[model samples]
Target: DQQVKQNSPSLSVQEGRISILNCDYTNSMFDYFLWYKKYPAEGPTFLISISSIKDKNEDGRFTVFLNKSAKHLSLHIVPSQPGDSAVYFCAARLKAAGNKLTFGGGTRVLVKP
Candidate 1:
């Protein structure tokens, strides 16, 4: 079974609106949670992340929330833009695992103008 999962295969939002993407995990040993954005034929770029010890982390319009009790997390994009349209992925790693990340099936975000 996959350790990380993104139940939503896709999400659509209008420009300037908020796009919320959800993720679930089975491993409690994870030390870090991360979100990445990628365009077609391009490598995924890190967007935002949160330590397992923290509940939330935000950078500009992107925010990541973690709930250890539920083994769940979510990524929120406020004021979504067309430039933000891409495939978003949720990934996690155990500090002891030495930077090996378990990635969830990505969620495709369509930010329509």
Candidate 2:
């Protein structure tokens, strides 16, 4: 059962533009949402995260928004740069699951300069 899904398999954006990534989950038990950025041959790195209690969280050029009712979340990258190009994965965690994470099919983002 794929509880989390990324409807779009890829996204392309020009440098200095905003890139929006979407994700949806079917599990209401999720208590946290996280986004990770992965480069070729590298492990996914934690990018940003949001708690179920909050609707939005921003850090520098990255921001994450969560909609509990819709079980949807999004990550926005402002002024995307060429170096920002990577595969982004959306993940959800159930507090009771204890470190277990459910990940969506990654969305590959390409920032064209």
Candidate 3:
């Protein structure tokens, strides 16, 4: 069963604007949330992550917020750039699963110049 879901298939944002990507999970056992960015033909690279214990985490232009009670999380990218155009995947890891991740269908983000 697909435990994680990204409702939006894509998002478009103007350069220098904020882009927000959302995800939801059916599994409450997941204890970690991560966002990965992928360029065409390239492997996804980690962008940012948040632990279950924290409500929010920020790093540079990327920030992740977790709402455990709602079983949802979001990634926000501020001042989006052209190079930020890519597909973003939302992933969740169960505490007892040990590195095994459940991923949602990616959301394609396009930052227009």
Candidate 4:
């Protein structure tokens, strides 16, 4: 069973719209959550993250929200662009879990212009 899960396999959005991706976790031990974007064969690039202590965190074009009690989190990309098309993964880790990150399957996003 996957500790972290991305229920949506894929998503599509217009170039200038917002893109939302969702994830859920089963472990109450997870203390940190992060979202990553990956291109073809390259490693996943870190996107936005939120600590369990915070409800939300935001970057320039990305935002992450966490609901500890519900064990859910979501990533929001504002004004999605064509270049943003990629496989987005949700990851979680326990501060005491030896730095290993548990990852969700991934959500493929397509931004159409």
- Give the winner by TM-score: 2
TM-score of each: 0.97, 0.98, 0.97, 0.97
lDDT of each: 0.95, 0.97, 0.96, 0.95
- What root-mean-square deviation over C-alphas does model 1 reach? 0.7
- Residue-wise C-alpha lDDT for candidate 2, range 1-113, written one tens digit per residue: 99999999999999999999999999999999999999999999999999999999999999999999999999999989999999999999988978789999999999999
Highest lDDT, which number?
A: 2
Candidate 3 lDDT over 1-113, as tens digits, reads 88999999999999999999999999888989999999999999999999999999999999999999999999999989999999999999987977789999999999999
Question: Which sections of candidate 3 miss by over 4 Å?
Answer: none
Candidates 2 and 4 compared: the better one by TM-score is 2
Give the per-residue lDDT of model 1 (tens digit) for 1-113.
Answer: 99999999999999999999999999999999999998999999999999999999999999899999999999999989999899999999988878899999999999889
Q: Write the per-residue lDDT of candidate 4 for residues 14-90, one digit (tens) a residue.
A: 99999999999999999899999999989999988888999999999999999999999999999999999999999
